[model samples]
Target: MLNVLSVLIGLFALLFMIPAFLPFLGIANWLLVPVALFGALIGMLSTRNSGRNFCLLVAAFGALRLFLGGGIF
Candidate 1:
Protein backbone atom coordinates (compact mmCIF):
# COMPACT_ATOMS: atom_id res chain seq x y z
CA MET A 1 0.00 0.00 0.00
CA LEU A 2 2.71 2.44 0.97
CA ASN A 3 4.79 1.34 -1.98
CA VAL A 4 1.85 1.89 -4.30
CA LEU A 5 1.23 5.31 -2.85
CA SER A 6 4.88 6.20 -3.23
CA VAL A 7 4.86 5.20 -6.87
CA LEU A 8 1.71 7.17 -7.49
CA ILE A 9 3.18 10.21 -5.82
CA GLY A 10 6.35 9.92 -7.87
CA LEU A 11 4.40 9.64 -11.08
CA PHE A 12 2.26 12.62 -10.12
CA ALA A 13 5.36 14.62 -9.35
CA LEU A 14 6.76 13.80 -12.77
CA LEU A 15 3.54 14.88 -14.38
CA PHE A 16 3.47 18.08 -12.40
CA MET A 17 6.48 19.36 -14.35
CA ILE A 18 4.33 19.89 -17.38
CA PRO A 19 2.81 23.03 -15.89
CA ALA A 20 6.20 24.58 -15.27
CA PHE A 21 6.68 25.21 -18.96
CA LEU A 22 3.58 27.29 -19.38
CA PRO A 23 4.18 31.05 -19.33
CA PHE A 24 0.88 31.70 -17.57
CA LEU A 25 1.72 29.43 -14.69
CA GLY A 26 4.37 30.74 -12.33
CA ILE A 27 5.65 29.76 -8.90
CA ALA A 28 2.75 27.40 -8.41
CA ASN A 29 4.70 24.75 -10.30
CA TRP A 30 7.38 24.72 -7.62
CA LEU A 31 4.97 23.00 -5.29
CA LEU A 32 5.74 19.76 -7.04
CA VAL A 33 9.16 19.54 -5.43
CA PRO A 34 7.71 19.03 -2.00
CA VAL A 35 5.37 16.41 -3.38
CA ALA A 36 8.30 14.58 -4.95
CA LEU A 37 10.24 14.82 -1.73
CA PHE A 38 7.28 13.33 0.12
CA GLY A 39 7.29 10.44 -2.30
CA ALA A 40 11.03 10.00 -1.78
CA LEU A 41 10.50 9.88 1.94
CA ILE A 42 7.86 7.23 1.52
CA GLY A 43 10.09 5.22 -0.80
CA MET A 44 12.95 5.46 1.67
CA LEU A 45 10.71 3.82 4.23
CA SER A 46 9.92 0.94 1.91
CA THR A 47 11.82 -2.34 2.16
CA ARG A 48 11.89 -2.80 -1.62
CA ASN A 49 14.91 -1.36 -3.40
CA SER A 50 12.97 -0.69 -6.58
CA GLY A 51 10.56 1.61 -4.79
CA ARG A 52 13.41 3.53 -3.25
CA ASN A 53 15.21 3.85 -6.58
CA PHE A 54 12.14 4.99 -8.46
CA CYS A 55 11.37 7.55 -5.82
CA LEU A 56 14.93 8.86 -5.90
CA LEU A 57 14.77 9.20 -9.68
CA VAL A 58 11.47 11.04 -9.45
CA ALA A 59 12.80 13.35 -6.79
CA ALA A 60 15.91 14.09 -8.81
CA PHE A 61 13.84 14.89 -11.88
CA GLY A 62 11.61 17.18 -9.87
CA ALA A 63 14.59 18.95 -8.36
CA LEU A 64 16.17 19.37 -11.77
CA ARG A 65 12.99 20.86 -13.16
CA LEU A 66 12.73 23.22 -10.21
CA PHE A 67 16.29 24.37 -10.75
CA LEU A 68 15.93 24.79 -14.49
CA GLY A 69 12.57 26.48 -14.16
CA GLY A 70 14.12 29.00 -11.78
CA GLY A 71 12.02 27.86 -8.88
CA ILE A 72 15.11 26.98 -6.88
CA PHE A 73 18.80 27.83 -6.83
Candidate 2:
Protein backbone atom coordinates (compact mmCIF):
# COMPACT_ATOMS: atom_id res chain seq x y z
CA MET A 1 0.00 0.00 0.00
CA LEU A 2 2.71 2.41 0.94
CA ASN A 3 4.78 1.49 -2.06
CA VAL A 4 1.76 2.10 -4.24
CA LEU A 5 1.25 5.45 -2.60
CA SER A 6 4.90 6.29 -3.12
CA VAL A 7 4.62 5.42 -6.78
CA LEU A 8 1.53 7.55 -7.11
CA ILE A 9 3.16 10.53 -5.47
CA GLY A 10 6.32 10.08 -7.49
CA LEU A 11 4.31 9.88 -10.67
CA PHE A 12 2.38 13.00 -9.76
CA ALA A 13 5.52 14.87 -8.89
CA LEU A 14 7.05 13.95 -12.22
CA LEU A 15 3.85 14.92 -13.96
CA PHE A 16 3.83 18.27 -12.22
CA MET A 17 7.52 18.83 -12.80
CA ILE A 18 7.53 17.94 -16.48
CA PRO A 19 5.90 21.16 -17.56
CA ALA A 20 8.78 23.19 -16.26
CA PHE A 21 11.03 21.82 -18.96
CA LEU A 22 9.12 23.41 -21.77
CA PRO A 23 10.67 26.58 -23.03
CA PHE A 24 7.31 28.09 -23.77
CA LEU A 25 5.62 26.65 -20.73
CA GLY A 26 4.12 29.25 -18.44
CA ILE A 27 3.07 29.10 -14.82
CA ALA A 28 5.12 26.05 -14.03
CA ASN A 29 5.42 27.14 -10.44
CA TRP A 30 1.69 26.64 -9.90
CA LEU A 31 1.95 22.89 -10.42
CA LEU A 32 4.32 22.54 -7.51
CA VAL A 33 1.56 23.53 -5.10
CA PRO A 34 -0.66 20.56 -5.82
CA VAL A 35 2.28 18.22 -6.34
CA ALA A 36 3.65 19.11 -2.92
CA LEU A 37 0.23 18.93 -1.30
CA PHE A 38 -0.43 15.52 -2.78
CA GLY A 39 3.04 14.36 -1.77
CA ALA A 40 2.40 15.51 1.76
CA LEU A 41 -0.97 13.81 1.75
CA ILE A 42 0.69 10.60 0.62
CA GLY A 43 3.30 10.97 3.28
CA MET A 44 0.65 11.49 5.93
CA LEU A 45 -1.21 8.42 4.81
CA SER A 46 1.93 6.27 4.68
CA THR A 47 3.49 4.27 7.48
CA ARG A 48 6.99 4.96 8.82
CA ASN A 49 8.91 2.74 6.43
CA SER A 50 6.74 3.66 3.51
CA GLY A 51 6.90 7.31 4.36
CA ARG A 52 10.68 7.23 4.40
CA ASN A 53 10.70 5.47 1.07
CA PHE A 54 8.26 7.97 -0.31
CA CYS A 55 10.49 10.78 0.87
CA LEU A 56 13.41 9.13 -0.83
CA LEU A 57 11.36 8.94 -3.98
CA VAL A 58 10.70 12.63 -3.67
CA ALA A 59 14.37 13.30 -3.17
CA ALA A 60 15.29 11.26 -6.18
CA PHE A 61 12.87 13.34 -8.17
CA GLY A 62 14.32 16.50 -6.78
CA ALA A 63 17.73 15.37 -7.90
CA LEU A 64 16.33 14.55 -11.30
CA ARG A 65 14.76 17.98 -11.52
CA LEU A 66 18.03 19.53 -10.57
CA PHE A 67 19.79 17.51 -13.21
CA LEU A 68 17.19 18.57 -15.74
CA GLY A 69 17.98 22.17 -14.93
CA GLY A 70 14.60 22.74 -13.27
CA GLY A 71 12.53 21.43 -16.10
CA ILE A 72 9.49 19.20 -16.24
CA PHE A 73 9.93 15.47 -16.63
Candidate 3:
Protein backbone atom coordinates (compact mmCIF):
# COMPACT_ATOMS: atom_id res chain seq x y z
CA MET A 1 0.00 0.00 0.00
CA LEU A 2 2.64 2.52 1.03
CA ASN A 3 4.94 1.42 -1.73
CA VAL A 4 2.14 1.98 -4.18
CA LEU A 5 1.61 5.48 -2.87
CA SER A 6 5.31 6.29 -3.22
CA VAL A 7 5.32 5.17 -6.84
CA LEU A 8 2.22 7.24 -7.53
CA ILE A 9 3.85 10.31 -6.05
CA GLY A 10 6.96 9.79 -8.18
CA LEU A 11 4.83 9.42 -11.28
CA PHE A 12 2.91 12.58 -10.51
CA ALA A 13 6.20 14.47 -10.16
CA LEU A 14 7.27 13.25 -13.56
CA LEU A 15 3.99 14.50 -15.00
CA PHE A 16 4.25 17.88 -13.33
CA MET A 17 7.70 18.42 -14.80
CA ILE A 18 6.37 17.83 -18.31
CA PRO A 19 5.12 21.38 -18.61
CA ALA A 20 8.64 22.50 -19.43
CA PHE A 21 8.00 21.30 -22.98
CA LEU A 22 5.60 24.21 -23.55
CA PRO A 23 7.24 27.55 -24.36
CA PHE A 24 4.74 29.79 -22.52
CA LEU A 25 5.00 27.56 -19.50
CA GLY A 26 8.57 28.63 -18.98
CA ILE A 27 9.56 29.07 -15.31
CA ALA A 28 6.36 27.30 -14.31
CA ASN A 29 8.12 23.99 -14.65
CA TRP A 30 10.16 24.89 -11.59
CA LEU A 31 7.13 24.63 -9.34
CA LEU A 32 7.03 20.91 -9.85
CA VAL A 33 10.06 20.52 -7.61
CA PRO A 34 8.29 21.55 -4.44
CA VAL A 35 5.08 19.77 -5.34
CA ALA A 36 7.02 16.60 -5.93
CA LEU A 37 9.11 17.04 -2.79
CA PHE A 38 6.01 17.50 -0.67
CA GLY A 39 4.48 14.36 -2.06
CA ALA A 40 7.74 12.52 -1.54
CA LEU A 41 7.92 13.57 2.11
CA ILE A 42 4.34 12.50 2.69
CA GLY A 43 5.05 9.16 1.06
CA MET A 44 8.22 8.75 3.08
CA LEU A 45 6.49 9.26 6.41
CA SER A 46 3.78 6.80 5.47
CA THR A 47 6.14 4.12 4.29
CA ARG A 48 7.82 1.49 6.52
CA ASN A 49 11.08 1.06 4.71
CA SER A 50 14.49 1.26 6.38
CA GLY A 51 15.98 3.21 3.51
CA ARG A 52 14.56 6.57 2.46
CA ASN A 53 13.34 5.63 -0.97
CA PHE A 54 11.02 8.59 -1.16
CA CYS A 55 13.86 11.02 -0.62
CA LEU A 56 15.91 9.24 -3.24
CA LEU A 57 13.09 9.43 -5.73
CA VAL A 58 12.68 13.11 -5.09
CA ALA A 59 16.39 13.65 -5.66
CA ALA A 60 16.23 11.68 -8.89
CA PHE A 61 13.35 13.77 -10.17
CA GLY A 62 15.11 16.99 -9.27
CA ALA A 63 18.24 15.73 -10.96
CA LEU A 64 16.28 14.83 -14.05
CA ARG A 65 14.91 18.36 -14.23
CA LEU A 66 18.37 19.74 -13.71
CA PHE A 67 19.89 17.49 -16.32
CA LEU A 68 17.25 18.72 -18.77
CA GLY A 69 18.38 22.29 -18.01
CA GLY A 70 14.99 23.27 -16.60
CA GLY A 71 16.07 24.08 -13.05
CA ILE A 72 15.64 27.46 -11.45
CA PHE A 73 19.26 27.43 -10.38
- 1-73: candidate 1 lDDT, tens digit per residue: 6778788887887677667656545365468767877887887787765655676786676566556767743
Write the residue-wise lDDT of candidate 2 on 1-73 in tens digits. 8647756776666676566545544245345545645665666666645654554566555555545554433
Candidate 2 ranges beyond 4 A from true positions:
49-73
lDDT of each: 0.70, 0.57, 0.59
Top candidate on TM-score is 1
* Candidate order by decreasing lDDT: 1, 3, 2
Candidate topping lDDT: 1
**On lDDT, who's better, 1 or 2?**
1
Report the Cα lDDT for candidate 2. 0.57
TM-score attained by model 3: 0.52
Question: Cα miss at 57, model 1 (Å)?
Answer: 2.0
Q: What is the lDDT of residue 25 in candidate 1?
A: 55
- Ranked by TM-score, the better of candidates 1 and 3 is 1
